[model samples]
Target: MLAEPARKFQSLAMAEPRSQQRLPKRLSRLLVVGFAVLIGLMSVLVLNSVLNLRAQEARVAGTVELRNRKIELATDLLMATYSRHNSLVYQTIVGDPFEQDDHFQQFIKWGYEVGKARNALRAMRLDGFETARLADQDALLARIVELHDRISDLARQGRAEQARQLIAVDLRPDNLKFIDSVDQLEHYERDRIQAELDAARSASRRAIFVAVGLGSAIVLLACAIAYLTYRQMGRYADTIDEQMRALEQHSAQLKHEATHDPLTGLANRSLFYHRLTEALTRAGQDQLKATVLYVDLDDFKPVNDRYGHAVGDSLLQVVAGRLLGSVRTTDTVARLGGDEFAVILLGVGEASRISRFEEAIRANLVRPFEIDGAELVPSCSCGHAVYPDDGVGMDTLLHAADERMYAAKRARKGGAAG
Candidate 1:
């Protein structure tokens, strides 16, 4: 009986941590899902608000356009009225039958234009003030039209003096009143459009404020949830401490493996490009100079073929260390691939400085290396291109340097043959 009880207690104790571990994972998953959903909701809300603001802006623009059109039509009508009056006055003074007939035709044309403008204005939606103004303007225009007709008839009948007197007394005053009424209507429309635009802008601003406030609130809620989740995680920290440390170490190793060559411990192609891009950006912003050196190890394949990949790898590692030691800490040394390496020299502006640096690297690399109890000498062909001089972009610089490297290699082979 005592053994059975002890076994049961041990089994329960073994199951406890597993159950506890599973609970935190489920809770964390829930929190993460909830946060993602909230962020998505916030994005939707912001996008909707932006779309709504855009629509409102479009509506305001249309309203402004309509108001301007109405004002333009009203001005056109006023100008046409003045032109009609001038034609009538001219007809009365000329006394030629043909001139009178032309004036009468011109007067009729202007009258038609005024009627069209008035009809267009009437078709538009209008507020109370605009409607009253339109009514008054229409009445004045009708009286002016009647006076113009009477003047034209008198001129046609050869009563030129009577027509001139009617134009001076009755037609001019009523035409002036009509022009004033049109002016008032345009001013009223302008004021109303401005007011509406102002109101819309205020409303848009308020909506933006509301959206910002809501986003902030959501962020705060997310932070609170994160804090609670962190606290819950803390409860199991002791249980998972070793596992967390192991995971962190694994992550660091993975990062290193991703960015560095496994054999030589130099930066790989991906990390090389990343650092090169960063250096280019910095140089552009600061107006500084930099250079890229493409280095190819001469006669490296014979050693690899003779002594196997192990010696070859060790030689590459020694070469990498030498390259690292040759440059400033700010510079980058990367292995692009087998027997191929690249170096970025920062703040190197002059050709002489780059030449000297390249010579140093070559001298260091040519030194005999004692690997696996065998001595070996290695030589490298180097080609360099300056920033903003050879090329500003990565691809251009790389191409220039690569071309120079091939030329150097060809020259070296030709010299050896000679």
Candidate 2:
């Protein structure tokens, strides 16, 4: 009786469905494949949108160039017409026949330029309205040319007075009308170009919106797939959690490395500028004052030359620590590379406050540092500039501070030489 019961239990256990046991693995694989497909689709959508935007930008650029060229040609035509009229007037007034001939030749040259500009303007692409405007301008230009030719003929025939009268009466009004027409045409072309640019921008924005929507959808789908996979793989949660923690730590380390000096671990130049900008902005809004102190290690180079780079680097690290200890928590201390460092002091109201802060930094740095069992004394030259007083900008403040720092350095050198 006992043997039969045990055999039945074994047979039941062996008969359980193996496919049901493998279902989670197959589901996980499916979710992974789906996620990959969604990502690929998203990439394709983004690329297509970018390509379309570039095409639209190219079109806008070409339209702008063409519009500018059209305006230039129109202006050239107007000026040439005016120059021709002036030359004709000059030809009539000049007493010397040779000089009169020379003025006539100049008039002919200007007429050729007008014809060339008109032809070029006609060759450009034009809308129906622009075409009509251009036609009207051409008619006006033709009338001006006719009047100019008549004036030239009268001047050549020694009818100077009659030529001047015709110019003052007939030529001036027609020339002004022609110039007005050219101005109108230029304005029309500029309006068209602006419309084209606006349309292109609108299209680009639409494409971006579509791309963003698609990308969001893809991300949501991927998240759903990931959630399902996570549900099926609950047994590996601890491992995933550990990896996430490690990744977060690595990301933090990378950020710190990017904004900090690797050796001294102080804020680097980029972070310094970022902080300085924020300080300046706050100072402006709060009606408070700030100061920037540019610091240079006076004898750091000799120390590096006498000792090796390792000792030099150690000395720099010590200097960074001293600088940090010298400033307020709200203040920023940064290593502007090499033996140079910067400090931004906030809410510095009076000149004496800056003097006190400078004195404290100097006092901290003047202490001797023990390196390689040898006593080494480091001295620094510091220059300071007040916000709004020196100038109301980061570059200006830094420049002012740098100038002061160099002046201090020069004074020290001079005193030592003396």
Candidate 3:
């Protein structure tokens, strides 16, 4: 009957194998290959994601440990500097001749030692708290140097009264600032580390959840695919399962490479764009808007031109990592080849989110990049384009955003902003 053929056509349409009339061996191979590819692709993605998350957690842990050690070292140096200053002041007041020369030399030695320590601490500028501390320490060092020079002159002229007057006013204020700066720096470091540790822990939990959820879903999909293929194979008397499995595996590898950057294994341009599109689409549906920022590194080409690509590559990796740390988990960051990067701000319905994002990026890039013990000074040119208003399509939005970025870059070149 006509109804029977229609039902048969529906069954064929839903069938996993090409046709239900094929041989069992052929059908089974087809089923296996198709399912295998689907399963494999999902499995690889889940695995790679888990691995990247673990690596990031390890990096954060290492950074926390490094900051703690540097803070302890800085504290020790600061205390020693404070002690030397106090000793010189006392020597001048008490007229202690026998110990004066030796103490003066020791004081100068401590100053040099402190300077070295400060230089070492400068490399810890990846974190915002540390950068602030670095600025404070710079100011503190200037004051300390002035104090040292003045004390030496006072000692030579035997001007105890003048020395005391200097210490009481100018020297005392800087000493207070130094002590306060140290304490503030330590507190800031501890708080920042704790917050980062907490974030890492939360990210770990979320990553596990995602891996488990996706893994389960993939397994279910594979099972569904296999079952459907097996049913068709029974009708056709052909092999199916093996082919599906092979297909699944190949798909998984391709997905891994697509989502991850080949060099750094961080998210690639495609993945970033995909996520941004998804966010923008969602925002559009909700009648809201978000922001897309194009970040281009300033003066990066000169380094590549001078230091060779090996060092230049290292610099890029370092900057990428720092930029990642600067943004929120919801933000999508991607390197768009060369020294250009982009970040997408999700759910940014208001202007404040854009402001905060800009501030964080500026703060992170404000400090120089220390590469191979040499400071690599660089800045960023950032331009933002809002969703919905900028453009409704991804390609259109990106083009607008890029134009804005080049505008910012030109502005930087013209010395309008740093």
- Per-residue CA lDDT of model 1 for 289-400, tens digit only, reads 9899999999999999988889999999999999998888888999988899999987886999999888999999999978888799999999988898998866557767
Better of 1 and 3 by TM-score: 1
Model 1 off-target regions past 4 Å? 1-23, 26-30, 157-161, 220-418
Q: Candidate 2, which segments miss by more than 4 Å at Cα?
A: 1-20, 220-418
Where's the lowest-lDDT run of ten residues in candidate 2?
Answer: 231-240
Instruction: Tell me the lDDT of candidate 1.
Output: 0.77
How many backbone clashes are present in model 3? 36
Candidate rank order under lDDT:
1, 2, 3
lDDT (Cα, tens digit) per residue for candidate 3, span 1-418: 9999999998878885655556787878987886788777655655565466657556665766675666565665565655567566654644556667766776777777777767777755556766776788787778767876887679757887677667766776787687677768766766665676557656555555554454456456755544443343232211112322443464456456646666655677656755886888789888878888888988888888988788888887777887888888777888767788888887674667777887788788777767776688668888888888777666456667777878888877788655
lDDT for every model? 0.77, 0.77, 0.69
lDDT of 1 at 92: 78
- Local error of candidate 2 at residue 350 (angstroms): 58
The most accurate candidate by TM-score is 2
Candidate 3 residue 391 Cα shift, in angstroms, is: 71
Q: How many collisions per candidate? A: 0, 0, 36
Error of 3 at 370 (Å): 56
